[model samples]
Target: MANDKTSMQLVANGILKENPIFRLALSMCPAVGISTTVMNGFMLGIAVLFVQVCSSVTISMVKNLIHPRIRIPTYTLTIATWVTVIDMVLAAYLPEAYAKMGIFVKLIVAFAIITMRLEMFACKEPVGASFWDGLGMGLGFMIGMMTIGLVRELLGSGAILGYDVLGFKPLLFFILPCAGFFVVGLMMAFFNYIEVFYKRKKGFTS
Candidate 1:
């Protein structure tokens, strides 16, 4: 029971408590930049997911051999390698998404969330724990992106995934880059509300 609980916590942490976007606010660039639409958000989210999981697993396997002093550079390089792979793949096969994403996909290398995990979680944990952490964080980030995108797309375009639901666009402002922050802020508030409610229900007061 204890092992299962630990593993569940590892996976759940990123999805809620330490959510990279809504909670931790780690990588806002892609969250606001490409999340103008669900398709754009999903594409970038997939790219981030691949990089996070792969880098975490790789770092976990090789952390001991890496010199502590050079670990930052090493993590950057490792993330860059995966970023390059995804970049090439996206450009070749998913050209439309690749174009829409443009430099944002490449920018994944410097995303604080990825490098932070490498240094903080992957470097110290066993491979299994690191894998769960990576998966959780990646999924959390992906969901955040999609949620933002879905709202923006619906509000901005009067559509969801290009299917028109509303006869008219609800709000043109939501499609704007600035709107990303506003939407994120609102979502963050809601997220915090739920977190607090859960904590209180669990009998915690802080």
Candidate 2:
């Protein structure tokens, strides 16, 4: 473990300061594509969480054995292995949601958030720290996905988790691809404001 950070700090960093979506702007393609419904976001987020945690720990455990020249491919293979496992699990147990998610789950191997962490943190951190880091990032990604999904679904469909609660759609455009970017952009601004407020509250900035 790194002496500079405790496990809690590692987790908090991923969840807040370095959120994969809102803060880091990582994995925007997937975020805007499949976040049309709450279920889709939750399911894909779970898949990513599993893959990220597994790959992070695996890479950390074998980091010393990997060659510097081939580490990129090595990381891809490690991530692919975990992605395959979760992909199959989702297909087998959650066929309906899997159908909805389609290729997004499989494409998690290409997610910049996962690959970046593997290269930047997992490859250098101890296994325990890597695990915490992965857990934190996985959770942050999941939360971001779910939040986007909830907003899009509620506004687009006037429903929550496919159940009609509002009785009428307010912003039908929100269901479209263009709205995905708009919603994300709005969310990014909201989070930015919150961060600024928090820093001011803590006297960390003027």
Q: Which candidate has the highest lDDT of all?
A: 2
Tell me how candidate 1 scores on lDDT: 0.89
The best candidate by TM-score is 2
Q: How accurate is candidate 2 locally (lDDT)?
A: 0.91
RMSD of 1: 2.6
Candidate 2 minimal-lDDT segment of 10 residues:
1-10
lDDT of 2 by residue, 21-47 (tens): 988899987799999988888888888
Q: What overall lDDT goes with each candidate model?
A: 0.89, 0.91
Candidate 1, 58-154: lDDT as tens digits: 9999988999999999999999999999999999999988998889998999999999988888998888888889989998999889999998999
Model 1 pairs in collision: none
